[model samples]
Target: MSRAQIAPPAPSGPARSVPPPPSRPLPPPPVVGPSTRLVDLAAPEQPLSPHDPRSVGEYTLTGRLGSGGMGTVYLGHRAGTHGVVAIKVLAPHLLDDVDARTRFLREGQTLQKVTGDYTARVHGVGFDGSMPYIVMERLDGPSLHAFVAASGAVTDGEMLTRTAIALARALAALHADGITHRDLKPGNVLLTSAGPKVVDFGIARVVGQTHHTPAGNMVGTPGYMAPEQVTGNGALPATDVWAWACCVVFAARGDHLFDGDNILDIARRILDGPGAEAFGAVHRLSPRLVPVLRRATAQDASDRPRDGAALLRLLDRSGATSAVGHAGWDRLVGGGVR
Candidate 1:
């Protein structure tokens, strides 16, 4: 689930295992073992605490997925239907914060319209009594942040390429719909069985919306924030591209390229942009990807690729030039980028 206290969590943890919710309960899939590429498998959901509700709207709360500063996500089951879902409810304290409440609901509404191979599906959004809540299809896997931290960098070249492309498309789709996922980082990319699905729109905005955060306050994870974000100018689609490039590098190298002692230090480096060493790292692992990231991480947003489609085209060209040929690209993209 997208979040607070959630950090792209709410049923998110490489360590935690969850059984298929009543929803989409296929026969048990093969157990994920040490040899498996994924970090998680069919496992038990965390038990709910006493304070957790027994039910929300039409869904019965079954277990705890996770919690964040804004709210807790519960594994929910509805009567008369086999569908199981993750339910995110606004914290009681936020009820009086009109801005937070409005934004929370807006996230739900916008998310409902955004669905494809690239994103988690939104099922419902409503007020269960006084509480505002969002219901989403439960995803079974770890975030890219957890995956890279636990397993190491995405060393498989083809998988890495596909990951870079899928994630780029996810953001592209968001921007196409006027939704900007302001917080695009490894933590928000879920490494699911189907491939990577980008999640968490907590800080996202529809086009032309005012500043999501108060003036002078930071909004995204520091290492991944774009220069525009650091300068407090405004977040653009290029801003997401900046974060995406950093994440791609992280996937290749198993670490963040920017290092700093504190928030201010990190912010300073972000504004300074990547150095020669960063490009060198990509050059060692994926020479073709270097230029794509080089442009994406440009200090000036104008210098970056225009949009996701533009990025996709760049990726296609990069893939074409790489050892992986056109037919290979087709298989990697599950027939096509659709």
Candidate 2:
């Protein structure tokens, strides 16, 4: 006999009939519950749109990190490795423009040789048929622009000093390679777990290259842009320093160094006002930062710190000490700057 048929029953009730258990143990009570999907903390990018391309070159794109004037940036992993990479593909229409093609190719070639902890290392460049794309290591953090918007100003003195130092180091690395990052606004400074990594070199030019764009055509964000750049004097090491100072002020005060009702108004403020005017809202700021900002954002580029290395030396002389000790540097870097 089967076990079910041979099983014995419990003692009968004294004065009542007992109910028999249902055949075949009842399926565990239906699991009716709300959905509780766990989120992926590792992935910081947005989901790919239905129309987004699934693959680029040898990488399979899984998400869209962001889009820019030049092209779309997709998050993906190389076919053979689990490591994530950011694939920036030039817009299809730009492929027909000779200048655009030249600049896109030059950006990758320039970054290939420029490698350091302060830079987002370029992995490779290739063409998906007619469209060209550059592959770089993906950064798992927000841009300085996004961070400031969400966290307001970085009021901690130690944080401000650390950020300024990291950016200066990155700039020094770039200048060492004879490259001037034409676009050094807060949006291009990626604050990662490793520290600040300067990015977006599309408009960057070699130190001695002649300006090809028309004199009247201006580039870069006006508020943070150096006066020389707004007036079409062409980008130089000093231009980055000016923007860097503007960024420092913004991070410290939660306001743009030069603000106005419109782009023209902002441009006018940057062009017409002195760096001191931008510090009106920054009260109780450490006296040490005053001269640094003044010289970095001088109306005349010649009056500012000559280069990134010079800026560092100036900071050292100004008593802007590092926020953390040698061990603390690693701890702060691992946790990321505010």
Q: Compute the lDDT for candidate 1.
A: 0.71
Mark the regions of model 1 whose C-alpha exceeds 4 Å error after superposition. 1-34, 37-44, 208-212, 320-338
Q: How does candidate 2 score on lDDT?
A: 0.68
Across residues 152-249, which tens digit of lDDT does each residue of candidate 1 receive?
66655666666787788887788787877777777778766666788777778787656446554556777787888777777778888888898888
Tell me which residue pairs clash in candidate 1: 4-68, 4-69, 5-68, 5-69, 6-68, 11-65, 18-43, 23-83, 23-84
The 0-to-1 C-alpha lDDT of every candidate, in the order given, reads 0.71, 0.68
lDDT of 2 by residue, 228-287 (tens): 877777778888888888777777887677777766777798888565456543335455
For residue 14, give model 2's deviation from the true position in Å.
80
Clashes of 1: 9
TM-score of each: 0.83, 0.81
Q: In candidate 1, how many Å is residue 229 off?
A: 0.4
Judging by TM-score against the true structure, name the best candidate.
1
Model 2 CA lDDT for position 197:
81
Give the lowest summed-lDDT range of ten residues in model 2.
7-16
